[model samples]
Target: MTRQMIIEPAGQAGLTAERVREVVAAHPAVAAHLGAADPGRLIVGGAAVTGRDAAGDAAGRAPFRASVFDPVANRGVELRGTVAAPERAEVAPSAWRPTPGPDELRAAAQILRADPRFPASGDVVVYQPMPPLADLERPDGTTTRRPTLGLYTPGEDVEHRIVAVDTAAGTVDWSPAGVSPAMHPGDCESHLPEPVESLRDRGGPDAVRLRVLDGGTELWNLIVVRPRASAPQNPGDGSGVELREVRHRGRLVFRQAHVPILNVQYEEDGVTFRDWQNQETRFSATGTDPVGWGWRICTRPPRTILERPDNDAGNFQGVAFHDAGGEVRIVSEIAAGWYRYVSEWRLADDGTVRPRFGFAGVRNPRTCMRHRHHVYWRFDFDVEGSDNDVIEQFDEVAPGVLKATPILRETSRRRRGTARFWQVTDAASGRGYRIVPGGHDNTADPYGIADLWFLRRRASELYDGNPDGDNRAMLDRFVDGEDIGRTNVVVWYAGHFRHDQNAPHPHQGHIVGPNLVPVR
Candidate 1:
């Protein structure tokens, strides 16, 4: 039988009719309640009441006063205590439904498993060549080749080899064949075990050893593991789990090693020198230590060596020195002809050694100037994020100056797809301006080598003196009116070296130049 119900917020005594009507209209069974001819007869409150039907028909309403014995203070105010007119009652279809059973859920899962579109596990290995280098292109658009040291996977199980390619003949050559233990390529699946202690126990002591052979020398090394012990668990089933302890130890040894260049050359009674490669040399005194010094031969008069005050000087790329009593010892290796002197000494009987001193200068070669020439530009980017996505295409703004577009990405809290822009203009003339957008943020991706051709034209117009000096002036002009502290300008530089060939090393002459541009 259909029934109309009204529920409302209870007041001190009961609910008002207006609140009852608002509640009934918003109820899930609102349609049925509206169809009733005498909704007022369904009054719900803490006191009994009588009311008429919607058709103005007089009807006796069931008294619904809350019982004094009821534990709840106003039980009669609940919708359960309400009733509609007799004529409004009508049998209706059942709308209640039950939840899905276990069988149904299992069947749904099985269907999903059978679908071909379901995801499955697969492995992919990204192989990047070792010791990356850049290839240069000639004016004719022809590319010149550079030696790439090929791939060398240190911890892989499969055999590793490099195949040299000859572009002219379109052929390849392989060398230095080697193999590692079994490994599932791409999947990262191997005989390695978790809780390394357990794996070591199962694989035995020698399973994790690494062996290497060079020329006639052979070296073997082992992997070690250690585990912490856990306390005993309680007898009760509710007690937490227990853990085990383990440890590992390994060592490496070189078998039958031969010294390639062990000749020691001595000078007078105070100095001993060793030379390997015409340029690589080492020096030391009879009573001093030479544990970490570079090798160099003394080709000139013996100069007083001084110790460096700062530790940084001794730790420089290829320099090292230490104090030994009254005589200071020095050792250095310079690719180009050069000599470095280090010294340290105590003043008379003051008992204080003057802070160390170090000096480096070039020696005269057979000729005045080296004829070798290489042209290159140094580009620096003052970006905040990853080094890869920072710089954008450089557009020539003038003959030599160029500007790069800044990439910025929309953040989560802000509206999506918003673009970031860099406004560039001449601060003095207020001319030569450009606006570019679509730059990524410093977070997700970083700025790398970006082309800066836009500023070339502007740079040419501003050029009157040195290229670098003029470039700095032009940048200053663009930022004149703007507040430096408040604005964000991602600056970076890039350039290519050509003609001269040299080994890639940290302290190479070409790499030891000023790269950062002062913003002030």
Candidate 2:
């Protein structure tokens, strides 16, 4: 009662639909692929048809629902409509009718308005089924169910076994057969280093200390013992050195645990001692990148400072000290290929630190229209007790550049507020950029304007003596161009603010920040 039809390129010479079906039936794989479809259905490379209506003309148009199955992509796209010619001469027997409502009319209007935005036209109606009842299917094509039972107990591991349960009394009890012996804090003098007699004499029992020095540099020094524990455990034998109880004078600064070679000490002249452990410690500093990147760091305690060249392949390249505060800031001229582009840290007065980085900026430069330059610094620190905390503050210092070429223009209706200026496109990558409303003001004072002009003229000197000459080149490039001299870089400002509940239905007078980058 059913028949099969094959579809191929329309212009293929001497190729018949019946012959293609015979070829498909001869191959087992092709037959299996065809059998996977609904019975009495004929399938082509990209389309399928069911020959159920024998009386209907093969070319006659009919309205029937089509559900396309894409096995390779594991997707089903359903299209509802009758097959008809461009002139709609015939109607199909499978057509179904549904009552329309005002909501459907409005939805149709919205769809019509959005149709112009895309290149092609076809009513795409999607049907999404509810999730399956079972997440996994068993070998027998049924779902495996879980057991509903109380807590399970394995008898072999039971040390204190439960012999019985009193169901009526609603209670169960067990007893331990034995208890493990407690550990004692015995004499721990084996880890002590040989005590220096001369240093102990100068600082007394309360001042006996140890310090770590790196390459003759005093990193950290702290009191190791007090008078209360100063009594030598073995006395004259110099075996178990001990100190008495007394208040220690200096602070204990540990080196980074990862870098064992880096030591810490305190020094006045050139002499240093090994007193403190070279363990992880945190500090702060501030410095500009060799190529003009800016950075700042703030900490509660002093920190160890380390610096390398801008060409060094790491997160940190330079360092600076922010007065007496534990602030170490560094900036790198070139951005790292693997490191994050930018990060902002919110430092609270109560020692709580919140960090937010540029998560959206990690784009591959080959495909991305934007390029990011970043600078970063690191600190090492040590604190007493297990709960050491540091608060860090971060800010955006420089805005990156964006380039685009002009596209369309709006000339008339200027007073109606729909006019726009020049639109530019990037020559290298055909991405478009717009030059919206932007300007600069210098109305503070005549002398102030003069000073600003002079500073702008001599901005190259601000490069100072950084290792990267690229900083000077950037300054020169900014000053030499006419557009750079007159044009103001786009500034994007965004923040959260409170609004009143009684605001107008369509609020006006508030300008939301510009959408500079596309968010995926």
Candidate 3:
């Protein structure tokens, strides 16, 4: 078998696993979670993020798979190693449609340059839409989505913003970071503004447009949007899902629908304890904390890396993987009292994405307790359509053969060992792709259950099994009455790791999440 593309090399100077353990060992209660996994084998926090230089420059020519660890993902990672990207489908987004060319992007930049609200530019960020367009949904049921030109800018003075221009009317809409419909920030992270470092497209022709942004110096997302002429159409009017589909000019950039929702849960004392609550991290391992949603975090400058997979073939003929993500260390009295949140996100040209969470800073000086972190990632798969279902398939081992199929599935947060992998499949077009969890089962925690949970989409199902960012008591609240049979559903994936002492210097942080593959 050909070797898989193992993400390694430092994009910028990275944190050592030993450093991570030092912080993990700070609090006894939190430290006790380590329970002897070996001194230098359990890294508490580090990340594997992608780094892309600005729009121009030879350094930015190809994309790069970056990490906080010098050689990231040398440890935790699970993916079918294939560097070959998909063949550009015969059909494409309309050439006549209003896709943003460099001219539009430059124009947008100039507009921001003169805006009173914009921060003075130092490191400027300009991007081209990968899917090359976006769809926004209206309140009326007639049309569920609208077309628009979507763009990402961190905003002036550290505030965050998303710029979406109505390609039809030439009007623009600006959204501040940390607003509702925005991803929830982690416990230690609620107090800081999310910083978006860069936005770029990978995979050439039919590339996935990825947004690499930072939060309160801690959170970020790998938002993947597939641009095509077949996307749901809109008249730029505020109504209709029933209207005919069109390759309309990019008008609306709708997210809350396409990307999944994810929550990071950390607990110790045998899953009976939790560390975050009420849209904020309740208290620090040091002591009970106070109000802090706008705390200051010193975020380091991002670095870059490059990757050229061994199996590079097809359309990736001579493309070198340029840095296409953002990697920066956000240090606040982050959590566990004094720790750093090394956040990283990588989007490859082959439709593979990784979101890694790493921690540094001071350790808990209290009890040495054992603990685990569970990232309950909620995904709303709007793959060409919002209404889709789950398909659990097994890699049935046989003599020179592998078999797969779908079945009525059940879920539990207290058990393990279910379907090895699954996908968000559209029942209508019989289309959709697989969501494969990386690393091994218990990739997140040995005691966690129902690695993958599927439920029909519901307004009430906005947060994680536990939304308040509260206790593990309400952990499975989202799974109680939800069903996943032939309906628009969200996929919740729990990826975590047990924290003990930090492993050795050369060790890597625990990276867990799914390697998203767009199924043909």
Candidate 4:
């Protein structure tokens, strides 16, 4: 295994994104590849951290991954390396065709708009849909699946068709005629403005800390990671709000909380298109800034709450803490293609932690189509500390009775009729949190089988890591039957949501998750 280097300051400042990009561009391999590539068609994005498990060596050198895309040539090269010294850097073997980043998505849109064959007339809005690309059959009858981008018009009614924009070949093609015909005029307006290049920089503080209080009493404190700092190269590491060292009244509750695995699978007629959170397009988590789509501080009565006069840290993606109704809420929005995901966490004064995932659609045809959004959260509970933590599963045996089962080994289970909830407690003190399922937290299908997964904490198992759509919801692979009775444990909770245009909730905007009630 490549010993990952943690980017930190030892005696000097760590490498910045610009410095890493300079080193990568200067590498012999990258330089050679650029020699033959057209400068006009080249798109280079900022370097991003690659690994979460760092060696924390004295050098403070960190692994960085970047990409150079040749839209005209329809090819991309991924460069991974570390800048060890001012004059020395290392580049790993070049990996081909990484998922499209924000830059690539924009480039694909431009390519499609320039093509004479593109049929769009009015304002053409481009989006990176889940499974951003599509399978195309050439005139020779040979089939090829390339990374694709989608385009649509916001207000006007147009015949709905998937415009597969292959950025690599600089080609534009439409999906076969038999698919869904008209696009759904969604409820929410599409505001997917291009990501601000300045805000997407990866060179900044490792994490931002926030403290919540109800006038005088300290409710809780936490460390939240920005999009770039969350390490997008790692599986399940990118694309959501990440919180660490969450404490309630000085008591350690959650070591970490984030959604590393998000699957947005679409079924049009009989054709299935699988999309992942981390894989296709590197969707930037949005904030209420220039785009008006990120976090906000609001009162319990649905009014806007101002930031504390003394707490002028400026919002990181508009994340703010406001104690309303004895509870504090932190919500962040992520624009994945045309779908906007609202990741919210509510921490109550009484010690109840509610993590919610809300699904809303922008102006797109798929918004009215049938689809399933499966979200999985990896919760690292420390209770008081990291050691002596235990997980227990509770089931309703009778109409008014319940049964508790101590899970001794790593395993995967589903929520049936009697299966209720699970709890993670400190074995010594019996202080933990009960994970109660929410009403919208539906069951998993074969593609997403497990409702709950309990496993011993392993850094390698932090995420599924597999971006291939063919392997959907494989969290069960982490269940190797390892003993987890009396050691540090991690809980993987999966929530499934079905969105159909014809349903009562036609808009398909709903929140699904669990409530973490403190147990003393």
Candidate 5:
């Protein structure tokens, strides 16, 4: 009785990066932006493939999109077209400036070093402390985005200084490092890893396509895309390290899984920074390959591991995969202005899935400031296919007693201080997976809206909310109380990390997520 899924795999390969750029460059807006800019200042961000149409039907030729950001002009453009027809690519001006890609970041560092206000140091490392965010508007209604860079001397554990340079206005502002009074013992004093030059240039496979197996029995087939640095200015375009497909033991577990919204709100501070607010200003992965850019396959033992690129000083910074005995892990180190994000996915030999996100900061102005990191992971679970799936909420009502309720309609929920979790099962087969909260998973504040959200699957509703227009969580807007009984269900889980400078790990260098254990 299991209903067959109509949704096509989102991992379908798309156009080549070179072809995507050619298509994007042909658009008038892009051509003009390129023509006016100084050579090499224009950044062409990576392209993402969208496999389905808005109506949820398979697109014969999946469309691919690329973004172009002009640092000097402080403007961005997004172009879209199908792999089969790159010449017909459509283009639109972006409402917000795109995040500075690896190339742009390097260029920004050079600018910072040239300014007289910059500390005279030749051995300093540079990185973006946080993912680039929204535009700073002027009184005249003109908006501009300054490329911000963090500077730190190698091996120094002290707070770092930041430089925000407006390439368009030929102005620069430097903010020296400051430590919060809350800083104390156990607060992380590590600096962000310096950018590796050849890491972005190396190209081999664009994706990690694997059939995870143990002793000749296949556990799952996984296809993952590295986190995208920047996306279009569209509402739901900024998804991170996409889990294109996760099929466990021959049944589709997740048709698509990704964190589209990563919003940060500094508590009480006048300054706020958010990533993926729009399709723009999102952090791109570390590599340069279009399809598999910023992804690496870790080599075992004796060889340095690339999977742990966020390791402290004097550690390996190359590969992004690790063999953890029963599970294979994939990690992507994403650079924001002064902070580094570790986005990881682990597939076990026993059909377990662990998705993790870590927040780490280098020496920077806000390193010790209190803030909340809100990350929303979208799980498009298609148990045993798609249509017959049911959503069940589990709560411990009494000592060792659990109550389960079928979610009949779309709704937003919170943990509410109870041992609460959720399950997605196929009504026909009674097969499913339980989503268990991680130890560090915390409750959301008022700004985070809710901790959990269940909604009917909609191809158009990729992102939970837009971070650009508003800093508060917006996933609640998608819950219109639509029928969700026995149908494709998309589960949204939000992980809240409260960065209190006084607490241990003040830099917020910790990983948080959930475990997906199969219900056999």
Candidate 6:
């Protein structure tokens, strides 16, 4: 599912090197904060931006078009139009910004070099910063003036690195996704759709209309897809890239939702919760800069949903794109509060995406206990469109249950082999997708009952629990009586584990969510 925003000729792309420099020069510290970095990667971006769209081209590279991945190396712009003199551009020091000098850049670069966790196998990139509205702006949401840097550490293997630095606070914090080959974006990309445009031309006369959006959600951030009015290239079988369902001419359209990006759940202490403490999904903060404008930093790019890939299989490696209007900002944060949950969202070239919740700061003034921070995600899906239906699909294991029909047993406390699934299909065309649990299901625990359930969609039925502690009652109420046939539905999937007392805090964190696979 993708949402196409603005499309204009390369020449009328509105962004210029001068304007790009204005944004970068304004945040010279971020530009300088390369983090003990990739000097060569700093100069030429990463090898991935070398414009390797064809076979003869080098490996791991993408077309040098106007993409979020291309901005870090270039001068915050992905060059377009006919005249291609310099393959890329750099933000040369203009009169507008005098604070950032060679010495300052050298100092910032030291930060990366000094970190023990900084990956030696990855390329460090300082991408452009986008206005805060990049994160906060909804369909009718307000615009913002403040911006943040997006630091990317494109690693050699599956998991990469991302660190958010507050220019105003000069404070930097990162997800535990610290450099480690073993840390892969687990089951993240296995479900979502592929970056099909990579297969077909999105330009010239026969381009397909597609949009990949970095949207907001209750507990986690989202990457919503709205490739309206398009259909699978291979319609009869469902085994094909989502191509524009061609009509005659002068009209190119796709369905409203190719797929519902993500819906997350946070379950802990026998109480299931979604979003913030009071269901506050949206966030706002004022930058410390002199102007003091409000900003939504979470919306910035390198919106890479999934982590990297262990195997080089082209289809398996995920895809992600973000628009960083030319200043490099790594992480986005919220302040003036007791706890800071650095919201880091990534979208891969493949459709795999994840919204990591990095919980920091103190919850209490005293002793912390050995408890679990359980997490789950409700992947609301529409296979072909809004009128789609869903069914429960499972393997031969014969799922075990909690006072229910069938129950699937967990292999171990750590291993919950996926024997459960929910298939969402379009009733009209019979085309749909599958929503699978990311890793483990909680059936083994006596308290844990069902891992997945199918329910019709409703505006008021967003959360599994309300203000009261009796959330399970809400679930019972929604399930007691509802139409399960020929209607829209949302698949609620969960994953959890007990956070032991040894769990690192104000230091370490966890990545939790589910996956929505487009079923061919």
Ordered by lDDT, highest first, the candidates read 5, 4, 3, 6, 1, 2
The reply for model 5, stretches above 4 Å from the true place, is 1-12, 28-42, 53-66, 80-83, 122-124, 130-140, 153-160, 168-171, 174-188, 192-201, 228-240, 276-319, 417-419, 464-470, 505-509
- The top-ranked prediction according to lDDT is 5
TM-score, every prediction: 0.16, 0.13, 0.39, 0.74, 0.79, 0.36
Model 3 Cα lDDT, one tens digit per residue, 289-359:
11122211212222211011121011211011223233222111112212222223344433443544443
Please write out the lDDT profile of model 2 over residues 326-441, one tens digit for every residue. Answer: 21111111111111112222222122212211211111111021111111111112222111222111122345433322212111111112222222222233232222321211
lDDT of 1 by residue, 1-520 (tens): 2111111111121223344444544444433433432334332212222221111323434422121111111011123233343223232322111111122223333433343633342321112121111233459764433221222233444322222222223332233122111212322112111110111111111101121222333321211110000010000000001101101111101110111111111112211111111121122222211222221112232222222221111212222222333222232322111222222211111111121222222211111111111111111111221122222334566777666654343111111223222333223332221223112111111111121222211211111121231112122232223222212232311221111112331222322111111111
Deviation in Å, model 1, residue 94 alpha carbon: 87
Residue lDDT tens for model 6, 366-454: 11333333333344454555544646455535546412122221111222454455555666675555545554233423333345556
lDDT of 5 by residue, 226-247 (tens): 4442222232445556665578
**lDDT for position 199 in model 5:** 27
Candidate 6: regions farther than 4 A off? 1-339, 342-345, 353-358, 397-420, 428-430, 440-450, 463-473, 503-509
What candidate 1 gets wrong by more than 4 Å, as runs, is 1-291, 294-317, 320-333, 336-366, 369-388, 392-512, 517-520
In each prediction, how many residue pairs overlap at the backbone (N, C-alpha, C within less than 3 A)?
Answer: 57, 52, 66, 5, 22, 60
Comparing 2 with 6 on lDDT, the higher-scoring candidate is 6
- Candidate 3 lDDT: 0.32
Better of 3 and 5 by lDDT: 5
* C-alpha-based local distance difference test score of model 6: 0.30
Candidate order, TM-score descending: 5, 4, 3, 6, 1, 2
**TM accuracy, model 4:** 0.74
lDDT of 4 at 208: 55
